[model samples]
Target: MKIRSFFTAILTALFGIFYLPSANAHALYVFAQYDGQVLSGKSYYSDMAPAAATYFEVFRSGIEEPILTGKTDVLGAFNIAVPDAPNTTLKVVVEGEEGHKVSVVADRTMVSNSSNDNFMLLREDIAHLKDKIYLHDILGGIGYIVGIAGLIAWLNSRKIKQGAK
Candidate 1:
């Protein structure tokens, strides 16, 4: 019986390893920003591979027709100057191979009035803020674990007192 049970557990583990959907892939994403006059961003695959020479289409807000079309450079970067765009937002669509297309939108809100050289510094600041928030979330999760453990201890103590009575 013991050997049979061990064999059964091994088979279950093997089946779980083979049949379960455990493989995870990072999702493809794009981020674009406007620098008062130009829109620019990089295109990348889920695996952090550069999407070189990818064709992109730009559409204005609520416009069915694309206003501009272009291709990325070897570095997977594209920049377009829209000095007189009437709309406040621009959408960039990258048509990737294997039907892995992605779209990103650039808005006027990202266009700071500061000097052009400050953009990289500003991006770093935003990244730091994200890190702080992530840290805060991790601390909150620890607090929740402690709270649940305390509750369980209190419940067990109450049960012990009833047994003593």
Candidate 2:
């Protein structure tokens, strides 16, 4: 026991001294848009080796502070809704496993969009409502009840099979 403790202490000290910290450089994304335009944002982590978990962060340019940061949902998209836009840049950053990643995200692709550009209507003033629909709003109370019942039935069937085995 004494020898084991001594060897463990020596190994720990050696590792602490020899382990070099890696500082990977990542580029910031810059976006341009017209003033007074409400912007919708969506981002996902891309380019990582197999068996590695994907992690990312989205932020505004210049200040280096994050506007939104989180794990992606079922759609693998972290969506953000901005109130206004003018000379703003949206940033996307992805890091993997203590930043020792197989693919280094050290570049940017710039895409320009005019905020005043109308999707459908010719005039920009009528851009507020452009074919928008919510799933919850459409489904209503009956839809929710049916969805719950289906989920319960599926779970119970799975549990029953497990028990049979």
Candidate of highest lDDT: 1
Best by TM-score: 1
| Candidate 1 regions with alpha-carbon error over 4 angstroms | 1-27, 109-165
lDDT tens per residue, model 2, 1-165: 954885687566446534632322232211212223333222222211122234555556576776654443443323334444456565555444444322222122233475333421242112222222234544465467557767987999899999999
Error of 1 at 82 (Å): 1.5
True lDDT of residue 131, candidate 1: 30
Looking at candidate 1, what is the lDDT of residue 70? 93
lDDT of 1 by residue, 64-164 (tens): 99888999898677788866566467888888766768887874545556675467446534533443324366457657865886798799989999999
Q: Candidate 2 overall Cα lDDT vs. reference? A: 0.40
For each candidate, the alpha-carbon lDDT, in order, equals 0.69, 0.40
RMSD of 2: 20.1
Which parts of model 2 have CA positions greater than 4 angstroms off? Answer: 1-53, 97-165
